[model samples]
Target: MTWRASVLTIFPEMFPGPLGMSLAGKALAEDKWALEIIDIRDFALDKHRSVDDTPAGGGAGMVMRADIAAAAIDATKARTPAGTPLLYLSPRGTPLTQGRVREIAQGPGAILLCGRFEGIDERVLEARDIEDISIGDYVLSGGELGAMVLIDAAIRLLPGVAGNEGSLAEESFAEGLLEYPHYTRPREWEELAIPDVLLSGDHKKIAEWRRAEAEKLTRKRRPDLWAKYRKS
Candidate 1:
């Protein structure tokens, strides 16, 4: 089945090439999936094509007009089946995880809403079927980057988006731990030799060594993930 994504943003041109450069890009080219960047301005009602309005309480930044954003999301969502959910990228959302991205990848399609200024009006979410997703704890100037990050992570999980099926398991966070060290080319680089285990040619031993290294790296760099890994 083909997986599709619809992105709603004020700046649609910021996408395409960026998303087009990675696995998601290749997926779009190969027809394994489809992605449509819908400009919210297209649904604007005014001559100046204003999609945002001054805050109701006189805030410093303008707020995204609920109706305009809602209309854009609705239009894109109607093109998909009922099970597909619309995702809004927000700083105050559930932190994204590999499992979540995998879940989204299995869907028939999805809609991504990119909020700007002071963010889309809260009423938009109340009126539509949507969930908020945050890539990290940090705030971003806009949701465009978050949407792109989400799409890239989801696309790679699709069949063939990743050229090496084995690679899916080795990448960082694939199984909740960081990836192990990798070595290539000359046995020695600048006098730093490749790991002896990798050169041993014993697949079982190599796998074991890699796992050990991955665990170590996770423990040192991401204790939170390491703690959860141990619990699981």
Candidate 2:
């Protein structure tokens, strides 16, 4: 299924490069999905096209003007389908997960709002059915980075987006564990030899070795995800 996504941000140009440089770039040019970048500044009303204003309670940094942001959202919505779902990127939100990416991929509804400075008004969120998703628990300078992360995750799930079907199935979070180790043409590095099992020419044995390595990697690196594996 083809998914159309729009990003509302003050720095629209910052994206498409960082995100569009590698696999995401190939996916975009190939039209596996559609992407639109809208500059929030374009929707501003002043001569300077200022989109931020002083905070209401006399804070340090300027807060993004609610009305300006709301107007940008409206403009983006105009380009989307009738029921497109909007997602606002913020630190004070639920951390994004793989499940969320798959959910968005299955539906043609996902828009990302990249906020700057202090942030957008909370009223706009309360008034809409928008989803607040954070890339991580840490705070970012702006939502542009977070939006890019979301975009990449969503793109990887699209059918034919990845050249290898097995690649997707073995990616971290595709199962309950991290990806297994990979080997290339070198076969040996710094006197370290490749696993003998991999060169045995037995596909079944190779698959089993990968699964075992993935389980070990998960238990060592992410105990929390491994715990879920145990429960299941």
Candidate 3:
């Protein structure tokens, strides 16, 4: 089945933005995957089409209404494939990982809810049993970008979406490493030369060198990942 991504957001125009220009775009055009854009405002009950309001007990910003969010989610869920996971993009959610992206990509697809302002009401998330996922620790103006980031990541993993399937296996996080540094032509550029092992064309030695470099970089740059890699 074609991998699918449904995004529900207040800003519908933001979607298929960057996702419409790169490898993801190519896959989309080829029907390797599909994108569904749902405007949250379309579910608003108010005459002004407002979807958010002042947080209960007072807060700094408006919170998205639970009713509207539920309405949008339910409508989308009805049309999407059964068992497709529903995800809400939030800073407090579990940090997204390559493993999770792979799992989602292998599934039927996902329904992403892009929260705005302070965020969607907790009740809707609880009632729908939606999973919250964070792209990173930092917060953005809204979840639209997060939704796009997630969709793009998953789409590339769909079969036939990537031009170089072999390269995907060596990409960063493919094996819980940061990935070894890469070098290109102009083998000797300025002062740097392509690693001798790479130029030697010895697959076995090249692989060994790459593993070592990946380990070194991971240990120095992401001790968290390195620690997990070691334990595993």
Candidate 4:
């Protein structure tokens, strides 16, 4: 079955933006996966088509109405395959991880809700049991970008989407450690030469070198990941 991604957002045009390029785009064109863009505004009942309003408790920004969000979600859920996850991108959500990305990629696909302004109504999220995912600690102007980030991450993992599946296993965060540095082409440049071990043409030694480098970089750059790696 084709991996599918359904995005519900007020800004429908933002979709397939970056996802419409490179490997993800190629996979989409080849029918390896599918993208569904649903405009949340279409569910608005008002003549002006307003999807958001002032917060009940009075917040700085408007909040997406629970009724409208629920309407959109319900309609989309009816079309999405059973067992597909419903996700809401937000800053307060659980940090997105490689393991989670892998799980989503392995599944049929996902329904992503892109919130705007202050965010979608909390009641709708609670009632629908939507999973909240955060790409990072920082906040963005909207969840559209986060949705794109997640879709891109999952799309690359689909079979045949990435030409070299083996390379996926070696990528950063694939093995709970940052990927090892890479080098190619010129054997020497600006006084820097390819590592002797890499030039040695010994597969075993090269593998060992890569593992050590990955470990070293993870330890220095992301102690949090290194700590987990050690525990595992």
Candidate 5:
């Protein structure tokens, strides 16, 4: 089955924005995956199409109305295949990881709910079984950018999306290490020569050097990943 992604947001035009270019766009055009944008405001009950209201306990900004968001989610689910995961992009959610991206890439697809204002109502999130995920510690004006980031991450991992499958193996977080540095022609630039091992054509030595470098960089830059790598 094609990997399908449905995004529920107040701004439908925001989707396929950056996703419409690069590898994700190519994959999209090839039908490797499908994208559907659902406008949450379309589900609003009021004639003005209002989807948010004041927070129950009082807040500086409006909270997305639970009933309206739920309606949009329900409508999307009804048309989408069963078992598709539902996700909400939020600041308080679990940090997104490559492992999670891989899981979603291996699944049928996901329904992403892009929240605005303060956030969506907690009640509907529980009722719909939506999994909240955050791209990082920082916050954005809305969840559309987060949804795009997530979709792009997953799409590139799908079959035939990336041109070099081997490159994926050594990518940072792929093997719990930062990628080894690379050098190209112009062997000597600014009096700096390409690493001798790379030009020596000793495959075994090159591999060993790369591993050492990757480990060294990881240990210095991301001790957290280095610790996990050492344990594994």
Candidate 6:
């Protein structure tokens, strides 16, 4: 089945924005995956088409009304393949990871809810059994960017999306470590020579050097990942 991504957001135009370029764009053109955008405001009950309201018990920003949010989610769920996970992009959600992206890439698809204002009402999230996911610790104005990030990650992992499938195994987080540094022609630039081992043409030695460099960089830059790598 073609991997699919359904997004419910107040800004439908925001979708396929950056996703319409590069490898993701190529995969989309080839029908390797599909994208469906749903405008949440379209489900608003009010004649004015307002989807949000003042937060219950009073708060700083408006909360998307539960009724409208639920309606939008229900519509997406009904059309999407059964058991497709429903996700809401939020600050407090679990941090997204490469493993999660791989899981989604192998699945039929996902339904992503892009929250705005303070956020969609908690009741709607609970009622729909949606999982909240975060790309980082910091917050964005809305979930549209987060949804894009997620789709980009998943798209790149889909079959035929990447031109060099073998290279995927060596990417950062592919083996719980940062990717090793890369070098290219023009052996000398700015008085800096390409690493000697890379030019040695000794495949075994080259692999060893790359592994060591990957370990060193991961340990220095991300102790948390390094710790996990060491433990595993």
The TM-scores of all predictions, comma-separated, are: 0.95, 0.93, 0.98, 0.98, 0.97, 0.99
- RMSD (CA, Å), candidate 1 to true, equals 1.3
Could you tell which candidate, 2 or 3, scores higher by TM-score?
3
Worst 10 residues of 2 by lDDT: 15-24
lDDT of 6 by residue, 117-154 (tens): 99888998888888999999998999999999999999
Candidate 3 steric clashes: 0
Count of clashing residue pairs in every prediction:
0, 0, 0, 0, 0, 0
Clashing residue pairs in candidate 4 (N, C-alpha, C atoms within 3 angstroms)? none
lDDT of 5 by residue, 113-191 (tens): 9999999999999999899999999999999999999999999999899989888888888987889899899999999
Q: With candidate 5 superimposed using the best TM-score fit, by how many Å does residue 94's alpha carbon deviate from the native?
A: 0.8
Q: How does each model score on lDDT?
A: 0.89, 0.86, 0.93, 0.95, 0.93, 0.93
What's the TM for model 1? 0.95
Error of 5 at 149 (Å): 0.8
Which lDDT tens digits does candidate 1 get at residues 50-120? 99999997869999999999888878877777788789999889999998998999988778899999888
Rank candidates, TM-score, best first: 6, 4, 3, 5, 1, 2
Model 2, 1-232: lDDT tens digits are 4688799999977968666777778888898888889999998999999998898879799888888888988878877887667999999888888988888887885889988898888777877667899888898899988888888888878888877867687788888899999887788899998999999999999999999999999999999999998898
Clashing pairs in 5: none
Backbone clashes in model 3, listed as residue pairs:
none
Candidate 1 displacement at residue 159 in angstroms: 0.9
* Candidate 5 worst ten-residue window by lDDT: 57-66
